[model samples]
Target: MRILLIEDDDLIVESLTKALTEQHYVVDVATDGETGWELAEAFVYNLILLDVVLPKLDGFSLCQRLRSQGNQTPILLLTAQDTSTSKVTGLDAGADDYLAKPFDMSEWLARMRALLRRGGASLPPLLEWRNLQLDPSTCEVTCNGQPLHLPPKEYELLELLG
Candidate 1:
């Protein structure tokens, strides 16, 4: 999964980036909302972890602008505010999910996975081509119920051919 992390706190950014990377996710960090919005517009991401308080532009406005441009990427807002109004505003501004500060990393990861699973955010874990099946997570390939001795590139090529 590819994630765009928009945060001004360096510690939070570093920690989340390292932790998410360890889980096999490609993470890009933007220190401010303007950069975050630009990057989000420029590339396709599996999820956007947006911080409400940011420099130049706020997360809420950025999300709204993104939605206005017809970008359907999932936005997960991370904020210190836990009020109902804040939640409502965030949701209204086009955030798909909201997580308050002092959150558990496990819960964040779980939520991210859930959001990705609910839509066309990331690639499927498995790919089937003709009579062959490839499991990307396990790096295993099978053809016609028989195991195939295939190199990684060769397997990918065959899968692409189909």
Candidate 2:
């Protein structure tokens, strides 16, 4: 799965990027809201991780704009603001989920997985076609219990067909 991470904090970006990569997710990063917006408009990502306080554009405005444009990509807000109002505002702005700063990585991952599953035609984590099975989270494929090595495009095609 591909994810767009919009965050200015280098430390947080580094940590999240490493963790997401380790989980077999392809991550595209933007340091500011404007850059993030441009990237999001140009590419297709399974999910977006946006920070509330951003340079040029705030996460709320960005989310609203994307929704206005009919973008249905799942958005998860990552911010330091933990107040009830902030959560409500984020949700109102079209965020699928919200995670406060200093959050547990496990919780973040779980929320992301749920959003991705819910956002994309309700696709399950595992896809199956006859004897073939695909595990999106692990990027693994097996045919009749035998592992199969496939190129990226082939893998994607199989996923689409499945």
| Cα RMSDs, all models | 5.1, 4.0
Error of 2 at 18 (Å): 0.5
| Candidate 2 similarity to native, TM-score | 0.82
Model 1 misplaced regions, further than 4 Å = 121-162
lDDT of 1 at 144: 97
lDDT of 1 by residue, 1-162 (tens): 578999999999989998876665668899998899889888888789999999999999999999999988888999998999999999999999999998999999888877776665355567786788875433457889788777545755655654
Regions of candidate 2 where Cα sits further than 4 Å from its true position: 122-133, 143-162
lDDT of 2 by residue, 1-162 (tens): 889999999999999998987666779999999999899999988899999999999999999999999989999999999999999999999998999999999999999888886865634479888899998855789999999988766876777787
**Cα TM-score per model:** 0.78, 0.82
